[model samples]
Target: MRETAYWLINIACAIVILVLLGVHMGVMHLDAILARLVGTVPEPLAWENMVNRGKSTTQVVLYIVLLGTALFHGFYGLRTMLLEFFSSDRAARVITAGCVTAGGVLFVTGTAVTVVFALNGAG
Candidate 1:
């Protein structure tokens, strides 16, 4: 049951990542394409834009969700790929451990950066 629950959670995360990342990319880059079509200058990708977006509670939360989902999907997918190359149970265990460690480090770093930007305000 526990293993099944965990697998379900990973599947949920993958679905969330797919949906949210699509929304994120559209929101972040659609303006450029729209501006071209409308014959206007698009918003510059500048520090001000970053700071503004980072300062938004909605954007911050969205980014946090994106980061978590992306990391889980990427690391979990990588672990599965790595496992396919190794036949030994011991090798699989080691690969899983390494994936978990790498994922944790990356997640922490990403979360810290998100928090810092959100807290620092316009920088």
Candidate 2:
């Protein structure tokens, strides 16, 4: 049951990633195109823009969800690949632990950065 749940979760995460990432890419590219049309190109990574985005509750939540799902999806994929390479259950368990640890650290860091941007009003 647990293994099945993991597979199902990964499938759900992948679907979510496809939809969310498409929207993300569209917004980023569209913003650049709109800026160009106005004869002014905005800096993509400007701290002010980032802070502004983070200031919006909806945008901040969306970013947090995207970050979490992407991290889990990518790390779970890595765990699966590592398991494939090692026939030993012990090795696979170790790999899973490592992946989980690394994913947790990265997720926390990403969330913290987002929160910092929101609180500081400047990145």
lDDT winner: 2
List the candidate 1 regions with Cα displacement exceeding 4 Å. Answer: 1-3, 32-46
**Backbone-clash count (model 1):** 0
lDDT (CA) for every model shown? 0.80, 0.81
TM-score of 1: 0.77
- What local lDDT does model 2 show for residue 120? 78
CA shift at 62, candidate 1, in angstroms?
A: 1.3
> What's the true lDDT of residue 34 in model 1?
65
RMSD of 2: 3.4
Off by over 4 Å in 2: 32-48
For residues 1-123, write the lDDT of model 2, one tens digit per residue.
977888898889899889888867755666777676676755656776656778878877888888888988999898888888885989978998898899899999999988777777762
